[model samples]
Target chain A: MRITQGAFSFLPDLTDEQISRQVQYCLGKGWAVNIEFTDDPHPRNNFWEMWGLPMFDLRDAAGVMMELNECRKVYGDRYIRMSAFDSSHGWESLRLSFIVNRPKDEPGFRLERHEVDGRNIRYTTTSYAVDRPEGQRYR
Target chain B: MDLDVVPMTGNVNLREELEAVGIEEILTQLDRELIGLKPVKTRIREIASLLLIERIRKRMGLTSEVPTLHMSFTGNPGTGKTTVALRIASILHRLGFVRRGQVVSVTRDELVGQYIGHTAPKTKEILKKAMGGVLFIDEAYYLHRPDNERDYGQEAIEILLQVMESQREDLVVILAGYGDRMEKFFGSNPGFRSRIAHHIDFPDYADDELLAIAELMLGDMNYRFSAAAREAFVRYITLRKAQPLFSNARSIRNALDRMRLRQASRLVADLDRVLSAEDIMSLEASDVLASRVFANGSSPANYG
Candidate 1:
């Protein structure tokens, strides 16, 4: 039931050293790192709430890690992911992304399958948090 | 914080990995549900094996860059290209290649634009919708307009190429069309051909395969042909194959629809007759023979 939207989801929630390693890897490739968090980790939910802005000038991973720590203090009950965008020629989208924070409860997702036309089954995954009203999904 | 890095190399088993990911189940279902694409099925199996090995390697802590999964499907109409694309999406999702397996099918019109500066946003919108899944472009060759000097398709193509490279781990784009025209398209657009990993050709179904498809379609509808009608349908298939625009399964489906209409007429023609379940479900040979396709000697205008 893990939200497998990014790298290292199949493994484990990364420690500080592992998170910094990934950030360093992205920074080494000249990618702009950004942090985002959301209570809804639905499969199609691409645009999570941005923590501040894309850190384009931060060359060191520790600086990004310090900013990440600040964001974690504010939204510790949400799923936060570190996404890096590469604006170089020929590739202008997210180059690297991985979840760096998750809720303590982590109530997971349920897949809904609809039988469409002949032998076609459409699948949709919805977060279990939607059962609660907005602004009160998590503690 | 300390992380646990286990020495997990020697304990990995490919068989257990395959079962854990249910790769075999997906392939088996692909074979069981689809008919007469033996070559396509085999190609899919090979790709599945490659992906399965990569998965096993990942379990053994040998992570590597995600391989490009973009593909091109070339074949005639009604050859199950879209169906196979759907199946491949499921395979990729199961193998942990993509986060979601939903297929967003589009064509040149959906991606291209009429006015200047409109194509990029149009294509980007579609790409955003297709992120985390597959973007299936049907008749993808139409995106290029060599004859037109001011076509917007080129802009769309550029955006597609960038996303195909940048967001490849999250999104897969599949270009589908007729074999020869697709070849010509790839010849002109080398960028597309270079990025695509697999080029699967869906062969036209043989007459026997088409017949099996016909029976399968009829069976699904809870309808059956009378003894003479079965032979009549076989003849219908032969005749239909010779006609122009002979789309394999699609033409057969249309033919069955017309026959069902004819059966309905035959039943309603007798207003007071007691109707049995067999009478309602059975299609007689006369119903199939009434089509303009069966008229011989002279060329009928509506032969379709």
Candidate 2:
């Protein structure tokens, strides 16, 4: 199963038009939109590689969509997401985040279990796609 | 007591009185109502002071970020965890933090949905109701069950984490359960662990504290224990404290309820005779002993 973790994971994946609407909503709130992509979709992986600096001065939704398209062209096989950052008082973190793209085939994680002492087990989750090299993953 | 009849100058004092009943007064009230758990009280006071100072700083334009109010209360059942969470809500409201000083107590069943595509909406609904107040999740460790592959509790927890972050300013989430189990629950969810700012441990009440709590409950109900009954209660609480399913203050409440039943039956047995006020209000030693026997499933051979 895909590790669905984000704002709108339970709903159907957003198309480019739906993504553009969300970007417009974020831009309407005076928030900066940024694109991010990563192979490791761990829930705690908060720092996804930034496609570029946050589109702070870009007020138009078309600007955000253009950048998002460029990011998808390069990292289309990886999980790409869009996040809106609110630099307002009392909140400096990402206010909204959602996955925009996923690999054609998502190879989910494998739960690695190790037996410790008596009746104790330690488990590690590793993404199966990451076992292959960067370009070969999700091929 | 009539506000209309009072002089205009009296309104000043009334306003002062209203202002006086703020966060500090709530803390004082919490201290008065709870019997023991000194450390728990102290931690709550610390949280109140921190929030108070933050408000002061924000007013002075010295700070911009609001402090996280999410907490974890680890202890056994009936050790005043829910009560403290309620008090925390009032404190936050009075201090101008949250809009409402209410506590919505829930367990795993209330947050987690039964099937797929149901957990997020259920959890979000609960969070929406808990906004501008405290969401007190009792036995929160049950929300994470790793052994059950079909359990949707983790989905509920994931929704909770997102809301806890997004709604930090208006809502406070208090996760409470047994100490060992809560520790294990935190161990499994590292993201959840990092978000919790305060961890208050409600230690089990000492024997004397339980007795005090029992007496307080009885007094509130216009009843008292006789001298011998007091001794009987102390013994009962001590024995029950060591047994399983012994929820400190809750056990006392149950025991008191049973004793009241026994006292009523005993009084009814002498229906023809005129009874004094003391006879009606006082619980006898036999009443306490009977409650103990009822709870333990047998007569205590050593109590006699």
Interface RMSD of each: 12.6, 15.0
Model 2 per-residue lDDT at B36: 91
Please provide, for model 2 over B133-184, each residue's C-alpha lDDT reduced to its tens digit, 9 standing for 90 to 100: 7889999999999899678998898888977886577578999999999999
Model 1, residue A39: distance off in Å is 27
Clashes of each: 0, 0
Chain B, TM-score, each prediction? Answer: 0.95, 0.89
Candidate 1 ranges with C-alpha deviation above 4 Å? A1-139, B1-7, B297-301
Cα lDDT of all candidates, in order? 0.84, 0.80
Clashing pairs in 1: none
Pairs that collide, model 2: none
> What are the runs in model 2 whose C-alpha is more than 4 Å off?
A1-139, B1-21, B292-304
